[model samples]
Target chain A: MSLISLALYIFEALAGAAALGILLVRNVFHAALLLIVCLISLAGVFVIYNAEFIAVTQILVYAGGVLVLIVFGIMLSSRIAGKPLVVTNQYVLPASLAGILSAGILIKLFSEQPFAQQPGALPGNPMNQTGIALMRDYVLPFEIAGILLLIALIGAAVTASSFYSKKQ
Target chain B: MEHTLILSSILFAAGLMTVIVKRNAIMVLIGIELMLNAANLNLVFFNRNNPALSGHFFALFVIVVAVCEAAVGLAIVLRVYKYYQTSIPDQLTELKD
Candidate 1:
């Protein structure tokens, strides 16, 4: 295997393990941390695939942004209160069965699809190409994405404000 | 690409397991995030060329949506916790009636 493939394997393993940790870990805080680990390793996986923009965005948006939101969620609610968040064991059998069934389906579908094992290297800097594409061909969607983000921000502020106003 | 797919699927399964098993509302949201991330990984791995219009753009958009989802979801969770004083799924069954 090449060095890049080796890196892919290691990072993928890290992400996979951290994903499992998120599932099984009892503490919500710890689970959130595990999720950060999983996300960061997946960013590494993105890097292995030569998706540097996505890798950086994964780290910035996921690890930096979303994780803080989750951790804040954890802290805001005193109900959970450092308690073990493990689920009831009754779900074990069904969860495992569903997991395996989906895995089988996923593997079957992917096997049918034709993905290139080794993609040709791009001629230009990916970031530059992405910027140009966003500005030219994908401009509408880019603007829509920005608008969606604005709507979400306003909606979140509105939704959360009810409690904030009541507290004052 | 195959290895990445396999790993992504495993991660998806783990996320599904968590969503199925966890009663905590926040934990379920975390599981949902995992599933979304797994999907994003698949998109990035299979992308051959055209980083801008390809999976990269979609992935970027998805990340934005994820941020929105997390913020709104957490806000709603906190609202529920404020009134109900519980974050467990089973106990918050007001809609069941």
Candidate 2:
């Protein structure tokens, strides 16, 4: 295969492995670390696909922000560290069966979908145009996302601080 | 080509299973994050071939939303832990039978 395809394969394998590791690992901190690895590898896949903007954002938002927050949350919420979180036996078998069936269906669909070959070197310089569109055509959704973010921040602060309230 | 999509789907399925089967709140959050990443992977793959940058933009927005969701969800989980002394979903079933 071509060099680009080879690189893509390697990155995809790494990403998939990391994601699976996150699922299997019981330690919450280690799981979060595996998730960071998965996210970074996925960002690499984005770069291979010429989605540089998304690649950077994946690293910035996921690896840098969300994963850190998750790790902190695990630390703050759990009294025990490096231990397996409590697991329930109620739905494990059914959930596994359903997961396998859905995965099979998705794999079938993916195989059937006719994906065109990368046609004539995809436009490598769309970042500027994409930015313009975000600010112009998609201004409303963009602003709405900002407002949502603000509300989330306020909500988190309020919820967290409420824990420290003195009882009257 | 097709393999990438298959892998993404597997990731999504595994994440869904984690969310459904795992009792820990943090594990559930991790599963949700994994599912979101799977969707982002699909968006990036489509953006590779499509001329329009819509998929890429949507992926960007998804990333932002995922971050906000994680922050807020974790904050709630922390509050729950403080009040209930546990983050296990089955144990926090005050509303269930």
Candidate 3:
């Protein structure tokens, strides 16, 4: 196998392992850390795909910013720091069966599709072009998304303060 | 050649299992993050060959949106935990009449 394919395989393995780790880990903090690893591995996959911008943003936003926020949320909400939450038998069978069916369908669909291997052409580095498109073609939605994030931030701050005050 | 798809499927399956088996609200959020990342991985893999740059661009947006979702979702979880003193989904039945 070529080096590129080898790297892809390695990154894919890391991503899969990290995802499983996140699921299996009982501690909330450990699960958050595993999620950071999973996001970083995903960033590596993006790099292998030649999406440098996305790779950097993935590391920056998801691994760094968002994961930290999640961990902080876990820490601040409750005093139960080390105990593992109990898993109930509410929807286990149905969810497991659905997961299995979805996995099978995805595998079958991907296997059947003839992935045309057109000599991997390095498409004219369109990172700059993408920025232009975001600013010009998709400007409205972009601005709207920004507004939504601002509203979410405000709402979170308000809710957090009220919740904390209520506890004391 | 076929490894990428196989790996993506595994990650997706793990995420599904997480959502199914874990009863903690935080665990559920982690599951959602895993599922979103699995989709992002597929987008990057497919964009490796396509020249249009659309898939890569969408992947970028998906990452951003995932971050925002985590932020908002975690904040809500924090509020719920304060109100109920627990993050377990089974214990959170205040509105379930």
Candidate 4:
């Protein structure tokens, strides 16, 4: 295998392992940390796929932003409960069986599908093209995404506020 | 490309197991995040050769939606914990008392 393919395999292994660890680990905080590992490894995979922008966004948004939010949730909830945030499995056997079976089916289906044999030529300036597409063709959806984010921000704030405490 | 697809399928399976096996709400949310990332990876992989940038744009939007989902979902979990004093979904059975 070439250096690039080797790197791709290595990153894929890391991401898959971290994802499995996230599921098997019981502690909420530890799971969050493992998720960071998984997400970073995925960023590497994106880099291999020639998606440098998506890779950077993955690191910035997922590892930096969302994981922090989850960690905060773990800390805050545990703090109030006065206990370390330990999680437990409920339906391990059934869940594992289902997961494995579904995965096998998906893999079989994916491999059977026809795909373009020759990989298309890479864009000369991917970043510039991406910016242009967002500004021109997909501008409407882009604006909608912004509005969706804004609404989610207000909704989260409203939902998380302690209305019961205020009433008391 | 096939390898990447297989890898994503594995990740999706792991996420599914996490969602079903874990009792904690936060962990469930993490599972959902994993699943979303798997789908995003597939989109990027498929769009690697396409010049329209549709796959990349879709992946970007997926990320945006994921952020909103995590934020709002975590907020709901926090509120549920405060009200019920537990983070396990199986415990929160009642809607209105």
Best by lDDT: 4
Task: Tell me the tens digit of each residue's lDDT in model 2 across A83-131.
Answer: 5454543487888888789889888888887896762346556777778
Pairs of residues clashing in candidate 1 = none
TM-score of each: 0.90, 0.91, 0.88, 0.95
Tens digits of per-residue lDDT for model 1 on A1-168? Answer: 888778888999999999988877878889999999999999998886778888999998889988998888787674445454444434778998998899779988887888766745667788788778879888898888889888887887777667565775
lDDT of 3 by residue, A1-168 (tens): 798767877877888888877766767778888888878877877777778778988888887888888878777754544544444434777877877888888888899987766326455765776677778877887787778778877876776667557575
- True-contact fraction for model 3? 0.64
Over B1-97, each residue of candidate 2 has an lDDT whose tens digit, in order, gives 4778977987898788888877789889999999998999888887777767889889988988997899899988987887777888878867422
Runs of candidate 2 with Cα error greater than 4 angstroms are A80-90, B95-97
Error of 1 at B61 (Å): 0.9
Error of 3 at B69 (Å): 1.7
Fnat per model, in the order given? 0.68, 0.75, 0.64, 0.87
1 or 4, greater by lDDT:
4
Candidate ranking (DockQ, best to worst)? 4, 2, 1, 3
| Steric clashes per prediction | 0, 0, 0, 0
Task: Give the poorly placed runs of model 4, Cα more than 4 Å off.
Answer: A114-121, A163-165
| Docking outcome class, model 2 | medium
RMSD of 1: 2.6
Write model 1 residue lDDT over B63-88, tens digit each, in one string: 88888898888888887876777888
Question: CAPRI band of model 1?
Answer: medium
Q: Residue B64: error of model 3 in Å? A: 2.5
